[model samples]
Target: MSRSHIRHELSKLESCLRKEIGELANKHQIKLESKQSSLCEIIEVLTQAKLCDEPLFCRLTKLDAAFCQLDIGLYGLCADCENEIEPERLAWDMLEQRCAECAENYEHQHRQELRLNH
Candidate 1:
């Protein structure tokens, strides 16, 4: 898909997620201060406050970062290798940061680290 199209999709998704979060925050009587807040700030506040579940917050965090990356012309590039990310992976999740090779290597290394720590 074109970058514009991808951005549009990401915007829609981010809006939806933000609305959901707003509703939950309202339910909990918490103010978002959205006008003054960045996505990272909002995430930090909500996370520290424990106002939302991990899964929801996690998704929003990814969306926020991905949206920012898009703005910076860095979207769809692997974070580690700086190569273009696979279409299949982006199709699965636009928030994906690592290409398949880097992802597999990261996982392998992480598992090794876990073993070492254990």
Candidate 2:
């Protein structure tokens, strides 16, 4: 696929995920602006850290990280491993970037660790 295609798809998926998260957050009494600010903060931090080649991942992760900041569903997931994150059990989150085993054992373990930490 073209880079634009990949980016477009990623954006679309990210938007959908954000909508879902927003609904859930709102239901739980969290404001959307708070979530947006949290996402912005994470993006700023990630940019400063100079991590990851894929900007789309960084963008999507920022959105998810906001959810994490809200103490909702940012479970520690091994993007390469596809492992069940220890909390909020997002088994249905089919768009997960990693499985448990593969994430823990990927060739770029060092990079993965850094990615997860960010």
Candidate 3:
């Protein structure tokens, strides 16, 4: 509920995500170097690994940005609506800064923008 508490939670989440990303990278490396698999299988494995890693990479970037925002005293506020994000939502995911309604609206608007761009 407090700013310090949120920062502590965010630090823990960042550490956990970093460890998981490292493990994924190591697993991907092992798959790449395994001679037991055929070339096609190796390619497929690497492709799948990339697919998995991309989202984790994105999350890591977001978490880092959130840390920066927190440092600047801007955490726990919705980016779209400038309202405080719910404590329960922040507890569920410290990386989330948007409250539920604003988040949903932002997602809808983002989808529309993507459709228009395409």
Candidate 4:
């Protein structure tokens, strides 16, 4: 796909993520002031959570970085092997820049190193 097309897709994904985060915040009642201080604390925690994208702003920021890479024609290209990621796999996850085989091999080697430490 063209650069413009990829950007357009990223925009759509950002919008969707924003909408979902908004829904999550509302569902979790993450208001500035609540009966329990824990509610506000949870919202603040969401702002920094890396594994879970509960806050709309934080999630959009991460997506923006990926879109920037896509704009530079670096997206979907493996960082390790410099190989083009398979289109079929990209269809499942556009954010995946590394090939599955490379990732598996890397993980296997990493595990062997940990085992040696013991």
What tens-digit string does per-residue lDDT give for candidate 4 at 1-118? 7777777877788667655655665676654332333323434545654325334555455465567677677887876797987888778766565688887888999899999998
Query: Which parts of model 2 have CA positions greater than 4 angstroms off?
Result: 34-38, 41-118
- Native-to-model Cα distance after best TM-score fit, residue 51 in candidate 3, in Å: 6.8
Q: Pick the candidate with the highest TM-score.
A: 1
- Candidate 3 lDDT for residue 71: 83
lDDT of 1 by residue, 18-75 (tens): 7777776777787786545678887987887885565778788888878878889999
| Candidate 3 accuracy as TM-score | 0.66
lDDT of 2: 0.49
Arrange candidates, best TM-score first.
1, 3, 4, 2
Model 3 ranges with Cα > 4 A deviation:
30-53, 113-118
**Candidate closer to the true structure by TM-score (higher is better), 1 or 4:** 1
Task: Name the lDDT value of residue 33 in candidate 2.
Answer: 48
- Candidate 1 ranges beyond 4 A from true positions: 26-29, 33-37, 50-53, 110-118
Candidate 4 backbone clash number = 0
Error of 1 at 109 (Å): 3.9
Question: What 10-residue stretch in candidate 4 is worst by lDDT?
Answer: 31-40
Q: Write the per-residue lDDT of candidate 3 for residues 7-115, one digit (tens) a residue.
A: 7887777667656655665866643433344324433554566653477666665676687778898888888788899989977877886899999998999899999
